[model samples]
Target: MSKTIESIFKPHLKPKEVYQGGKNPPTSNGKKIYKLSSNENPLGQSPKATEALLKAAKHIDVYPDQTDIRLREALVKDFDGQLNANQFICGNSGSEIIDMLLRAFVNEGDEVIYSNPCFLPYAVFSRWYGAKQVDVPLLNTTYDLDLEGILNAVTDKTKIIFLTSPNNPTGTYIPKSVLDDFFTRIPKDIVIVFDEVYRHFADAEDYISGLPYVTEGHNVVAVNSFSKTYGLAGQRIGYCYTTQTIANYVRQIHKPFLLPITSIEAAIGALNDTDFIAETVKTVQVGRKYLTAEFDKLGIKYWPTQGNFFIIDPPLPEFEFTDMLMEQGIMVRPVSQFGAPGKVRITIGTQEANEALVKALKK
Candidate 1:
């Protein structure tokens, strides 16, 4: 009764592609590195979060609480202290939560809806979990969510719908009205997840956070990360808010102790760092305006984005543009993998980095 290991492996198993991200060019080689990529917090982490990390570092030998009690309490307070532990689930990364959501609800032949040219990171998870990822095309370079098109794509097999307001790379958002209507039309049985990793950066009047629906008994989950705004990308701590029942289901399928002890402590520290959050918002808004102005002056076409990153179609092809930027010791994401062969995504960095990018583009 000896079965070969290859036969036992899931037949649907497909080799995954290696994810390419922005690189922090080392300071050597006498080249000045200006990294306006990877949508990271250019200013760095909050002092409070940094202090908390240092303090927590002393307990390196001990295992962290698997329940992530402290981080949950911090999330409660951050959400006005109205919700409790059951409403939340922390993960090693927002990417991990994406994997958990698909694994918990999606099945073979079940459909999952998402925007094309979005956080391609999710594609790896959705495909690996056996859910057929139904990609909806973006309207323009920004990929303003095509609500009507997505609605038409849904069917009985659709198990999950994802909305990344102020969507990745493109930085375009679905209006609140469109979102409300989608919520009304979609069957409540289907799980909806609002990936709001850049929520703090979005101040557009049309942009709306999906937390209110979570409180309204809608089968919705709000997934976010401490990486971008809180500067915890390396720590990889993210949390999800949803109904208790879904949280319980996620727990059953979720890998145990997913949030390492240090990550939990770092997230708790990040929550209390309100000043750092405020500073990050102010910096991005200021830099965003500046970036848009540069685009306007150069007559470059771009979408108005409420999030920290946005897509732009320069006069040249992105592959060549990206290579040029890399040679200059600057990193920007080219959108070929996200389905846009000609456009590139740029993240707002510090003032200095932004200015350098502007000059680089001008040349």
Candidate 2:
């Protein structure tokens, strides 16, 4: 009998689909391509961060602090007592912390709850651990979490609940009132993981991060990434805030020396560069409005957004519309994989890039 690699792997691994990130714009036509596919900062990395990274290169020979103490302290200081350094679990990225949370809390036969058409990683992590997934459908049209539905779905088997503010692809968020109610009703034993990766972009009056709940000593953890506001996606640095108990458990499962020295230095610099953060947020806010106005003029249907990207229900199929845009040297994300059919996500780029995207959509 011939032995196969698949035979040695876990049975569930065979059916697991790989995630497809946004593609790099095609340069075959030699046209100037404006990449608004990935939700990246159009202004690029913080200049202060860049300088810090370059300076930190001199110490490449040494290992990074295994615990990321300085970054954790900075986070606590930023939050003004909402969290403490001991309540943190710094990781290579927010996604990494998500994975760690699942590994630490979820077990085979346990159920994990999340909204459909949300961040894909939540479902992926649950599946990887052989856990049952309970996906509640979003409220129709608005794409907000069906809080009542999620509450009803809870069972004794449910171990974790994942919520995202300014949720990926759709850009909608859970209001503070809803969160307050949900926290009150949910089981205290069940862990709540709030993915607030785009928290910086959210300006809605009702939006709330998981930090306050964490402050109140709820079983909640809020994940944040430097990738968005700091323009440090390439650095792959992020952190989470939870109770000291949960934080200690997560740190046990996390790899040692997880963050590179340069990444840590860059993130610290990014945190300190208030001017760069202000400009980046302003640019995204302006671009978001510009895109919305332009889409309105073109009679395109788009979801209202609180993040750096928004979804558009195009006249044609999403992939078809994306291809049409690509022909004009523009790139945007198709959301079919995210379970939002007939929709595409357009990242808020610079004024020039946003205008070009609008012009292409018009064509």
Candidate 3:
């Protein structure tokens, strides 16, 4: 006789798939766990950021800058007037900013276009709002963005196009020339959500982040995170820069005082620590090359990467490969959940961790 919970829910709401984060490496029998799953900065956070957080702890009772104005101004200064404070909106993480983009623009039955095996939040959140996901499959051989396929898939119903540099799992990106071609062909009215959270580690000669498009006043919203580059994943700070029009819409939904005081201060500190950032990028570059060379020596097939992580097309099934890696006290990401079977993504970690990963794969 009890009233059912489903009866009161909105008719459009369906059971959405939960996002799977990287697992914690288990410590069993005194084995050291090397976590290479989440693509986190294995080097850890900046000392300057740590100092800033500790200093800010004295003012725990105080609220954060309601406008997040300080971080916005820093970003403006960081980018050197290519953008202004009014064009940015800081969020808890890049994921939240992506979600906000959907909230501000996508309506029911709208179509969101993105490559398959991409950052899952785009699909997950689009469905949360009853939007249809139009996934363009990756080219089988290269595992890169199928720009031709993407163009063929677009329709008038499309509201947003999600693009990532050094894309998730595969770590493949659309080359600048390809992006330019696509932009010229695609409708300018459709919003492009360009996620470049891993930009700092990407050293490819032809790579270009979305900021240039934003400066040209294209309908592009570029999202970057302090998580990976600044090693502030724990702090959960990120920002999105876009046209003034898009920023105004996001501001309507993104309330003030959303970010905390400690996180804000740490992010500011992380931004100013240019020496730490340069060193981190250099280390990641070295590690990336080391892992790639090791993979080649092992005769393992991997996608060339611009990001700190690379994808391996392992001989064994992905789940089995992951289990084997776990037994060796190293954790790597399996891409079955990301829609690629028999493939795994490995984060390029410290020299020691990278060496250990290759050793485990050899067995």
Residue 162, candidate 3: Cα error in Å is 0.5
User: How far out, in Å, is residue 54 in model 3?
Assistant: 1.1
- Candidate with more favorable, higher TM-score: 1 or 3: 3
Tens-place lDDT per residue, model 3, 1-363, is 788988888655666576888887675778887899998987899999999999999998988788888999989988987888999999999998998899998999999998878888888888878788899978888877888888888899999999888788788887899889988888877999999988888877889999888888889999999988789998988999999988987799988899899999999999999888988898889998898888889999898998888889887888888899899878988887787777898888989998888889888
lDDT of 2 at 139: 85
Tens-digit lDDT string for candidate 1 (1-363): 888778767655656674576676566478787777789998888788888888888987976676776788889999996677878988888888887888888887789998887888667677776778798887863477888888899999999888887788788887889888988998868999889999999888778887878888789999999999999988988989998788888878656566677788788888988888999999999999999999899888888888887788867878888888777667887877776778888989888988988888888
Superposition error at 203 for model 2 (Å): 1.1
**Where's the lowest-lDDT run of ten residues in candidate 2?**
10-19
Report the alpha-carbon TM-score of model 1 versus the true structure. Answer: 0.95
Off by over 4 Å in 1: 1-5, 16-18
lDDT of candidate 2 vs native? 0.88
lDDT of 2 by residue, 111-181 (tens): 99988787788888788888898989898778988999999999999999999898998999999999999
Which pairs, if any, clash in model 3?
Answer: none
Q: CA lDDT of 322 in candidate 2?
A: 87
